[model samples]
Target: MVRPGQIYKISANILKSRLQMTIRASISCNGVEIADVTQPVKEGVPEILNMRV
Candidate 1:
C-alpha cells in the first residue's frame, strides 16, 4: 500500500517522464517507414505495460 502523498509524487513523476518521452520520438525503419502503425512503442502487442511479464 502506498501513503497519501507518496503515491501522488510517484504518479506525478511517471506523468512527467511520459510527457518528456512524448516530445522526443524517432522512427524505427531506415529506408522505409511502417504504415498504419497503431502504437509507437509496441506495434503487435496491444498492452505495452504487460511487457514486463
Candidate 2:
C-alpha cells in the first residue's frame, strides 16, 4: 500500500534465467513530464529505477 507524504522507490525485476535488457520510461502528470528514467536489468536482479513522490 502507498500513503501520502511519503517517498517510494519504483523498481523492476528480471526473473528469466538468461535475459538482459534496458528499460526506458517516463513519468508524467497532467500531460507534463516529471521524470525520464532508464534502467538496465540483468537476470535474477532487481533494479531500483526511480524514487520520488
Candidate 3:
C-alpha cells in the first residue's frame, strides 16, 4: 500500500537516474548491443528493450 506521493516520487527518481546515467552497453559476441529492460519482467530471464548490431 503506497501513499499518495510515493508513486510520483518513485517515478521521478527513476526518470532522474536514468537520465543522469550513461547509455554504455555490453555487447554480445554476435556484436549486438542490448539496452533497457521491459516491463512484466520475469526473474532469471533477460529481455532487451533495444538492441544495435
Best by lDDT: 2
lDDT of each: 0.24, 0.70, 0.31
Model 3: lDDT of residue 15: 29
Report how far off residue 33 is in candidate 2 (Å).
Answer: 1.3
Error at 32, model 3, angstroms: 28
TM-score to native of every candidate shown:
0.17, 0.61, 0.21
The candidate 3 region of ten consecutive residues with least summed lDDT is 4-13
User: Tens digits of per-residue lDDT for model 3 on 1-53?
Assistant: 32322211111112233233323233334465333222333333443333332
**Any residue pairs clashing in model 2, and if so which?**
none
lDDT of 1 by residue, 1-53 (tens): 32222211101112223332212222234555322122233222222221110
Winner on lDDT between 1 and 2 is 2
What shift in Å separates residue 42 of candidate 2 from its native position after superposition? 0.5
In Å, residue 31's CA in model 2 sits off its true spot by 1.7
Off by over 4 Å in 2: 1-8, 51-53
Give the range of the ten consecutive residues with the poorest summed lDDT in model 2. Answer: 1-10
lDDT order of candidates, top first: 2, 3, 1
Candidate 3 residue spans exceeding 4 A from truth: 1-38, 51-53
Query: Which ranking of candidates, highest TM-score first?
Result: 2, 3, 1
